[model samples]
Target: MKLVTYLLLGVKKIGVIHNSGNVIDITDIVNTDDMNVLIEQYAAVEHLLKKICVDSDARGLPLADVHLMAPIPAIRRNIFCVGKNYYAHAQEFGNSGFDSSAAAGNVPAYPIIFSKPSTSVCGPGATVDSTLDPCNTIDYEAELAVVLGKKGRVSDSDDPMTYVFGYTLVNDLTSRQLQKRHSQWLLGKGIDGFCPMGPVLVTADEFGVPANQKIRCTVNGEPRQEAAISDLIFDIPTLIKTIGQNITLLPGDIIATGTPAGVGLGFTPPRYLAIGDKVTVSMAEIGELTNTII
Candidate 1:
């Protein structure tokens, strides 16, 4: 089932997505605070969903009735992101004549992990301030985001799937100018409203086949990037397994799988985002995630 974090009547609440485009409030069913506690202990979010499913109130509103927030709104900790996990994206940034000075290199044998400030996460329809900082090069990356259900340390024997809650779409907004200047990603990617996610977070069981999902990204109604999740070099399992071996993966923790090629920077003149540009990232089982650049 799909889960959503929403604000209705000025109160934030949680709910399960209904087939009729409505949202069933599972807030009363699951112990949300307890779920947060479990998350702190690196426990799964699915357990909470299961509880909600078993004991839900009849009170539900149409998805159109509430204001949606990030599926895991107000996560106790920051979200994690994987960078250049796609060979094509790594090649585009390192070899695509956009940054002619850099040399194309071999894909890193290990996952390149990073962090996007939790504050940057916004929900669908949220306005992303492309010009928020003084950076001139605003870029967009479409990635499949994985939400962790529990925490685990990085180790060889770790099973990343056991910690997974579900998946969602993420727009890895970037300030290319800043990125090049510092050679670090934090400032370039951690700006408020940079990581726009969710209309809702679909549970893993509801996500259909993990390897066959279709992922595509479009800007202003035109397709820019398209590929299957199958193309990922550091697939979800590897990512979780690798990352978990080193750090504790907690519930509500997000991991944005790297994007495919065809980003604005990969264009002839290096097309950067402008005021009012719209970016839409979609997947087959997961819902669409759209945001406007301001």
Candidate 2:
């Protein structure tokens, strides 16, 4: 089922997108005002949510009528991100001359991890602010993000999929200038509205294994990034194992699996995002996330 958090008549509600393309408000059935609360109780409520999705009498609102919010607009902590997980992207980034470390080589034996503050999260169709200082060069990275369902430390013997809750798309927006100046990623990647996510969150069962899915990004309807999830140098299981070894994975924790090669900075003269530019990040089965620069 495709789950969503949306606003209708100025009231935010939890909904499930039916196969009929209508959004069924499960707020009454779930009895919760917060999506995070519902997600935390997902295992207990999955059956009921599925039943509501098929109930003909269940009231539903046209998808176009409601404003969709990020699956989890305000997360409890920073968003875990993998940098240069795609081999091609690593080569491009290494050659970009922005990172002294990237100059060493394209592929790293270990995952290059970073975090984006929770404040950066924004929903599809939202407008991103681009007028801030130190953000003259904005870029987009389309990625397939995983949402955790249970609290556990991933072990070599454990099946990582068992810990997954769902999948969503994330446009890992970046400020190249800040990234270079600071010599770190926080200020460059954690700007408010930098992470535009969601249209729907597909449950793990429906999303299946996190491999070989088409991930792409477009700017103003022009294709910029395109690659398969199979290209990930450090796959989901490895990421979970690596992160879980240090920090416990909790329900609703998001891990962006990194982006493919066509980021604006990869170009010779860099095609950075500008005011009025629209970026659309799409992952097969998970749906698309589009945001515009204001």
Candidate 3:
């Protein structure tokens, strides 16, 4: 099922995209306006929600009539991110002189992790601001994000898919200058409107194992990044087990599995984003997320 959070008639509601491509508003049956609440109660209510979708009398609106929002419009905590998980991306980043490790031509034995504050979360088609002081060098990272279904520390022996509820696309926007100057990624990657996610969240069963999916990003209709998820060095299972060892993965928590090669910084002189530039990140089975620089 493709789940979504949308705005209709000025009220934000939770919905599911029906087989016909229309949206079935399930808020009334779900008895809440919060997607988090729905997610928390998903297992218990999954059947009922599915029934609502097939009911002949159920009312549904054309997808074009509603405005889409991030699957989890407001997260309970920071977004977990994996960096340099892709071999080629790691090499490119290291060679670009921006990597703190400066380990050019070497892939890490483990996943490089980071976090993006909840404030950075935005939805598809949102405008990303680029006028902040010293933030002139903005870049994009197209990634496939995993949404946790329950809270737990996944062990290496455990099935990581058991904890995953769904998958979505995320554009991990960054300020290259701030990244290098601050010597950390927080200020550079956690800026407001930096994480543009969603169109819909495809459940685990629907998306299957994310590895081997095609991930790509385009700026103003020009392709910039492309790679297969199979290129990930650590993969999803390793990332969950590694991070879960310390932090508890909660329902609604997002884990962005990092980007591929061909980022702006990988170019000869580099090509940063400017105002009015449009970026679209696409992952097969999930969908595409597009945003414009303001």
Candidate 4:
């Protein structure tokens, strides 16, 4: 089932997307506030969702009637991001000769990971502020994001395939200059309104073959990045397993798997984003996520 967190008439509620292309209110069946207590609640929440199918047929709400919020608008923790996981992205960054030593032939054997401060998170249709400092050179990266359903300690032996909740699109906005100046990725990636996520979240079952899913991004109407999730140098399981090797994984935690080749910074002349540029990040099976630079 396609679950959704949405706002209807100014009130936020949880619901299930129906077959007839409608949204059925299931908020009354499951307590939204209780979701934060544990990951297992997702199973219970799903159980109650079964009843909505009946009620929806009789009194279901149409998709056109409500405003959609991020499947989880206000997740309690920072969003984890993986970098240089796609070989193409690594190749481009390396070939650009911006990092000459890196360009020649240096690639990390492990996943480069970081966190986006929770404050940077924003919902669908939200406007992102472009803090266009004179020294700032901002860029965009489109990536497939995984949402965790089960919390596990880094030492846990279970695989990540069992811990996933769903999938969503992520735009990892960057300030290239800040990144280079600080030698830390957070300075470039964690800007407010930099991470635009979700039209909605698709349950894990709905996104079969998570690793092989196709992903792409376009500026305005021109395609920039295009590749498959399978292109990831560090696949989801390895990423989760590796991160879990030290850091704890929590439910509602979001992990951005990294982008493909063709980012603005990878260009010969460097095509940074300007004010009023519209970007659309899309994946097959999953829907398109669009946002504009301000």
Model 4 has a clash total of 2
Pairs of residues at least 3 apart in sequence or in different chains that clash in candidate 4: 85-233, 154-244
lDDT of 2 by residue, 173-282 (tens): 99998888888888889998899989789998888767868898999999999998888999998888889877888888999999999999999899999889999998
Q: How far off is residue 149 in model 2, in Å?
A: 0.4
- Give me the displacement of residue 160 in model 1, in angstroms: 2.2
- Specify the poorest-scoring 10-residue window by lDDT in model 1: 96-105
Q: By the lDDT metric, which is better: model 3 or model 4?
A: 3
Query: Which residue runs does candidate 2 get wrong by more than 4 Å?
Result: 102-104
lDDT of 3 by residue, 165-209 (tens): 889999999998888887778888999989998989888877876
lDDT of 4 at 265: 89
TM-score of each: 0.89, 0.96, 0.96, 0.91
lDDT of each: 0.77, 0.87, 0.87, 0.77
- Model 1: how far is 207 from its true place, Å? 1.1
- Relative to the true structure, candidate 4 reaches a TM of 0.91
- Deviating ranges (above 4 Å) for candidate 1: 33-59, 96-104
Across 81-188, the per-residue lDDT of candidate 4 in tens digits comes to: 987778878877766644432223445587787889877777677777886434557788998998888877655667668878888888998887777666677867
- Candidate 1 per-residue lDDT, tens place, 206-233, comes to 7866788878989999999998889898
Output the lDDT of residue 220, model 4: 91
User: Which scores higher on TM-score, 2 or 4?
Assistant: 2
